[model samples]
Target: MSRLLDMKEFGEAAPFLRKSDLEILAAQTVAFDDKPTKNIVGAWILITDPLCAGKKRAWIPDEKDAYIEVEIREIDGDKVIVETKDGKTYSGLFCVTVNPYKWLPVYTAPVVAAYKGKRRSEAPPHIYSIADNAYNDMLRNRENQSMLITGESGAGKTVNTKRVIQYFAIVAALGEASSKKGGPATKTGGTLEDQIIEANPAMEAFGNAKTLRNDNSSRFPLKQNQSERRRGKRLLPSRQCHSYTREALMIIQWNIRAFNTVKNWPWMKLFFKIKPLLRSAATEKELAALKEEFLKLKEALEKSEAKRKELEEKQVSLIQEKNDLSLQLQAAATEKTCRLYEDQMNESKAKVEELQRQLSDTNTQRARAQAESAELGRKLEERESLVSQLQRTKNSLSQNIEELKKQLDEETKAAMMAEELKKEQDTSAHLERMKKNMEQTIKDLQMRLDEAEQIALKGGKKQIQKLESRVRDLENELESEQKKSNEFQKGVRKYERRIKELTYQTEEDRKNMARLQELIDKLQAKVKTYKRQAEEAEEQANTNLTKYKKIQHELDDAEERADIAESQVNKLRTRTRDPGSKASPKACS
Candidate 1:
């Protein structure tokens, strides 16, 4: 049996171990009955041999090593010979072996295959293979498995446990994916594989620590329970399962010193008694969230307070402006300047009205003068026509006078010839009388023609002189009326300009009044808002005061309760010390 064990180890390490090294190992005696000799010899040959060491594989001493040496000298089934570097020979189960990195892969490969699908018996004997096979059997039987991994502080227990969990998670996830035709499905909206993998890191963060033998060593024991639930035909992990591993470890640590003294205490009763206190204490996460919320509320309150202060400042400025405007209004009402402007406006209006009346009068006068001038013009035209007619009559009279004078001269000649002829013929008395009558009539007509000429010339000259005087008088009157009309137009323009100035000034005053009224209304509205804000601030302050008082009251009540509990604990200790208290307990019951 010892030879077969040696051969098996040799066969397993043959790929990396040299033939000379195997011959040296096989030449040694194999001990199977002595468990310590068998294990030590096997560990030394497989792990500490220099021929089996690769570039990354070397021997590491145990923590208790006092010196380095090739201690193995001989081997046998019943006894083994070992020699230290100082030539000290010893044979016993008390032996130290070095850990070799080269053996880990050789050990893990078969376990990995066993996890895949290979039979556990076909794999080499290893703790990992055994655990893997057991986990597989449990999964096949649809049963639960509980694994408790414990060792000395630095035995790599935590690391081995993490490896086991990783193997199980990977193999199980693959199996689940293969069972479903589609693929691995995370119906819970989270990757189940990742969550299972992450549990190691989360647990290590709180539970693992560094030690001399191991960097990541679990300081406390862990109890992991994995179970499958049968719902009709489907076998799945139980969703309601919970692990209080960390809490249990914490409780153990808390009562570690007093565990022996209070070993018989009723833990269930004590836990119930302190459950309310545990609930009252704020958790780290809850306290952190509350601190963050408090800070945010404080910042918001500060901003609101700052806004209120700004509004108050604005209200003060508005009040000052309103007061100033009121003072100005009062001063304006009392001062003489407004009355003076009004008087000036009234005077300008009166002047404009008077100028209008004057302008109207000038218009009427101008119209009358225009009418008189037209009448005079008509009379002048009539006088001119009369003068022309008199001139024409005078011209015709002159022509008639000339023709009559010629005829008279011819008649006088004829009369002289007739008188001579009558002397010759001894003229009759009736002829002499007719000649004398004709000469007298002719002399009377000539005198009447000369008087008519003098009368016509004198009358025409007097009419022309009267018409010339009337035309000059009318022209002077027209000139004076036009001057008055021009002066009235100038006055009307001056009054219109003054009126426009007054209207503009009144319009400006009206706009100013409207603006002031609007400003006052806005100030009043701001004052109301400020007042409302102040009231709200006061109410909030009062509410905070009430809350502070309530918290203070609760704090006092909690302190009183703590004092009472401490006194009762002291009294109980005293009663426990006194044996007479036992009888009192029986009497009370």
Candidate 2:
């Protein structure tokens, strides 16, 4: 009774709540973080044992069945990556699906039916699961529920939405509702369900084509639907209002109390007591008493009218005060909005300027890197072409040396046989020494060629110097062999011409080998220098690419901030109306 009276005494006023008295502090909430007031609208609630935080990535501990259990964990994002690799598209409340781009058995009738009564937690994460939860919540709370299906273009938002709609169609169906409403004589001449289902294809083809920038977007019907159903839904709110029901109820209660008090009056009791005695004696005293009562009732009625008029006037005064307060509130709200938008716009402008400066610096650096890379690239290509030509020349020199060496062996063998026929032992000994020196020089030349092919600059240079000294010794030996041959010219006369020709050919081959060795050393050195330049160029290019990407990202963020500022400006413009321009409400007759 005391609580009732307290409530009645405090009637018709909005309730008051302080921040400290708000119900935001639950057992799970450890503390409120109000330090970050600039970005978010409200303070953040700090909680303990968060499922995922403070980690780059982690795989779920349960490796065997990550798909079966999508609950968020202490691990950050590794489990999500692993799940994607294993074809698990959903993680907790988020349905991160890929476009299968084809029909699947997952959304069949049986599957839709399976999710009808099950709670979201009872099933694996899916679009149907979300829809089922929404439906269940709407039924349980007697309120509407909305699910936003939003993503970038080609993200299957439409496909997922269709699945949700199909799920609802199956789950919220009244048994044979179509047949009961649109029987055989209906316009479609089919079950009401069929006509309803047919309307959806037309709607999906055009109405739900994302014509509106809002949730559950639909196109306005013009040459479309042309149905009474659409017209009936165009009702607007009524402008008429009535007297406060609370005040009316209070007036009724007062009148009832007054009537009860009058019923218990002493005059009423005396009249009942004297009714039988005065029934036959019609007297002027009774008439005078009745007249006095009528006058008293008339005065009472006049008083009630005055009291009612006073209450109406009081109500009007309260309404006037309320209107003034509303106007003040609107002004304050408008000012706050303007201030907030101005701050945001200023911050956004500063950020954009900073980003532009950074981008200009990045462009300068990129231009320098590109210029250097282009110059280096041109030089490298030119050197590479020279290296290719040198390589081919070196190969031909090597082959020619091999053929000349074979000729030397044959000519030496023939000269030895001719000397043996004449019994020239001294010449034979000298010829054997020349053959040994020639073989040693040939081995050195082969080593140099091998080093050249490998582009070993230091090793090939050393080998080439050794070959030069060896070639000089071989030339002196060849001269001695020529003199020895002259000593045995008579005994070995038949092979003299062949020996001279072989000597001349050997010297020419020696000169060619020396030139090839020099070319190999220079090629090896150029290759080393070119390789270094190429590496530097590649590293610079990578650095430039990374810088460009970073600058682009910052530029994108700046653009988004600027867009937000502009949108806020637009919102303020829409809401900042002239309070005095509003007309007074029209009174009903």
Candidate 3:
């Protein structure tokens, strides 16, 4: 649970396990948790055994046959322990998947790491080696076992599968080397196996490629086996894997069998030479041996025109001989010189002439019959010759038609084969280009990831440095604030000292005000004494004024008259108001 929790915390790490980072541990060292008291982490087991199958190409290990299992255990607070079914345990940081059985080489990790250097071939051991070993065991013991492999499409399933099969074939073919002994086994040996191996490179170059799931997938079609009826008209059972081809030995065997059958047929046919026909069998001793056999056919044809001509000449000679005999008989009768003899000669001539007439008529009738027969024979022979010529012409035309059809068939087959080969080549080339492109893409992604990691490291360092600087500045500012707080305390002490001094000065000013008020009252009493003396002097002057009043009355009357006169004079000067300012100026002048 702790491992699972840790993985959950680090989520991205779980899903992006590269092939280079993943490792398959050995079966023996793996341990499983069996105690009920201990916590279970996970189960580990071996899922495949490449060496079990008789055919190396058959890569799937049979589950019912064999497997290795392991279980992981957690102990104490920080320790992880692995315990196996065999009662073995270990303490370490461990990685456990569902499968633990298959023992892959430890060098796989380093080899995978070298992919950046463009070297991928060395990572894991080829399955072919295991297959070869397994195949050897089977052959040595005369045993056979079926192999099965199951995996998702792109996980090197087909490639591993092919390697297993190839291993088995190579191992099984080893005995074929002995066939070089010039015995029957020599025909079955290395030459045949070498050809098969050669064919594989060509097929792989054509059929394998990069699909969405697999970097190198094969595109071969499933071969189907079919049963065909041959000319023997018998059921010949045979076995073929899909797309199987017949071996060269099988073809040679078929031809030999066909040759033997043709020699044992029903007819006894002859093939004598044509030159022996020209020589006469009677004169040539060697030819005489065949005389009786061929002479009868020659005689039948010889009795034709030549024999008829010879028979006509022989009939003429016989007629001329009979006339000569008749003339002699007539001369003998005349030599007798008697009258009866003369009468007999005359009778003989008449009989001869009558016989001649009958002979002539017979000859004419025979000639006419022969001419009719010859004409009929000629017509029959002409018809037969025409029929024979027509048959020969028909045979020649049929042979030419068959030959033309065969040539046309061959040309058509060649064209079709050429088209098929071109298509296969094009498909193979396209797949190769795709594989190259995919590999390039994978390399680019790896480089980008490395660049991102570098950028993140630099940013993290800068952030740490900034935080450190901020902390130092805050420390300095705190010291300055403490110093300002001490200065404020000193200023409060000075203000308290000044406040006490002002209180004393205020009390002294109140006392001085009371003294000034007393001085002002004494000055007011002195000024009242001087004012009483001046009142006495004013009483004496009032008596004098009463006596002087009588005299002043007379004088006042005189002064009144003087005042009136002055008033009159002033009126006379102001007598006329000027009508115009210019007239007033003339009067003043």
Candidate 4:
């Protein structure tokens, strides 16, 4: 009845449209109630602007614009509706839809109510739930299956597809955690490090494209991180998940190489033929002018072929120049490598010479120490000989002193025994008899007594002096022996202490010698290891040098290839740059 929607109106409505606005009014619904009803709610209603007035038609809206189909039935004053497109249903008071966002809460309320007993709606349902279910089904029920997402550009299709992948990653990872020890994880091992090193070029190439709408549109890009914690002797695990956001792009190029780039290709059958009539109508000119264009086209064709041949020749020459450049670069690199090796060789020779000098000095020091030690041994032997002679003299003097003391003790004991025996005889009789005998004997004894008295008196003085002198001599000898003994004991103690110290020094020297030997062994091993490493390094350097030379050659070859391509391109361009080119060609004979 009113002016129908135009392109501007449709565009605006797509973004901001109310459900009630597209629906038939309550008055119209009541009028049509008795007949087969055309309820606007949940029904497709097409509106078109016809050039001719008063003619109307309805067509089904495909998944082309903002349209969805629903099924509804009335019960008293309420409408029970199922959103067939998204598989959701609702029961509510029969009223025309006004706001979709506002109505979503109303529609999903019934689903919430139905599932409330099971706590199925504990978390708020988001758009991702659909994708989550699909992901689970694919992984659990349909393993090895593929998912295809087809849609027009900028329809949130790519975003939805990414959401599906995330759903799989999250749910599967959680499941893996429940089954495995250490939970949802990522690779923190060396393999991941290697992969990261390898992925640089892939990211650069695939995720870059120029677009008018988007300055740089990336199809896929990713970032990864690994974290590690020491758990006792082992490292704890980590988790990784991919998050993706999408943007739409405009003005993309499509390749026509297989289809339309060449004539009489198999795919050419797919396109409609261009007859002479169609071609004739494209230009506005007379027959004679058209023939003149045909002749020009022939000339242009010939010129193009000549340019092609010239480009090919130039390309060959450019290749030869690039090869020559490569050889020169390789030669320079070899000279530089040889110079570096020579420097290393000189340094090694100098180090060897210095070590030899040090070895010679150490040998001279060892010889001098041996001579000094031998002199000390000779002095020690002489002192031992003197000690032995002094010990023999002291033993001889002790034996002589012992023999003299024994003889003096025996003489004193005999004199005491004779005095006791004389007192034991009969006293008076013996005295009277002895008196007569004594008187007679006295005269004879007197003479003997006088002689004995004379003898006793003379010997007493000499014997007394001799005994006194002998006592003095013995006391001096005993004092000297005691002093010598004390000296010997003191010397023994000193020598014992010295021996103990020497024993301790010997043990320490042995330990030190062992440690030194160990250190020398370790140093020798290290020297051998370093030598091997140096040799390996030298070999590796040579290999790398070879590779570098090869790369230089390749670079030269690439340059030559580039030069050749450029020359060919230039020659073709020059040939094409004539004053005029034919626009048309004559028909085949």
Where does candidate 3 stray beyond 4 Å? Answer: 1-74, 78-124, 143-146, 174-589
Highest TM-score scorer: 2
lDDT of 1 by residue, 142-198 (tens): 554445455566555666565665555545445545335553222322365344433
lDDT of 3 by residue, 1-589 (tens): 2112222321233232322222433443569654423233333222222233232122222244453333333333333344435433554222222222354432132222221111113222223323333344444555543344444434445555554444333333434343354322212235644544433422232222112113222322221222344412222221222123245435556887986776465441221343355455545876665787578767876886577789888878877987887776654443333344344445544554554554455455445544544554454455445445544654564465456456555644664575466557645754675566457646744654465467666576665565578568757856875685567557545644544454444344334434433433333333333333333333333433443453355345545554554555444334423234557788899
Q: Candidates sorted by TM-score, descending order?
A: 2, 1, 4, 3
Which pairs, if any, clash in model 4? 186-238, 438-442
Worst 10-residue lDDT window for candidate 1 reads 232-241
For model 4 the local lDDT of residue 210 reads 10
Candidate 1 or 2, higher lDDT?
2
lDDT of each: 0.51, 0.61, 0.43, 0.44
RMSD of 1: 48.2
Q: Write the per-residue lDDT of candidate 2 for residues 1-589, one digit (tens) a residue.
A: 1111122211222121112223435533766563412121122112232333453333333346642322322343322111222343332356667776775556655455445566655544567777777666766776655567777666677677777665555554432353355531112234544433433432232233222222332333252456676544442111110123234445667988998898789998898788988855677678888999999999999999999999999999999999999989988988888888788878878887887888788788878888888888788888888888888888887887887788788769866885675566675665676577668657756766776667575566776677688778768867876786677666556477778888888888889788888988888798888879878877987887798788788778878877887887787776665333343233321
Could you tell me which 10 consecutive residues in candidate 3 have the lowest summed lDDT? 111-120
RMSD of each: 48.2, 35.7, 78.1, 35.3
- Model 1 residue 45 CA deviation (Å) reads 73
Report the poorest 10 consecutive residues by lDDT, candidate 4. Answer: 241-250
lDDT digits (tens) for residues 422-515 of candidate 4: 3334344456655776587568557645665776766767655655785697578668756965775676566567556655655665565566
Error of 2 at 485 (Å): 14
Candidate 3 TM-score versus the reference: 0.18
Model 2 stretches with alpha carbons more than 4 Å out: 1-337, 424-522, 578-589
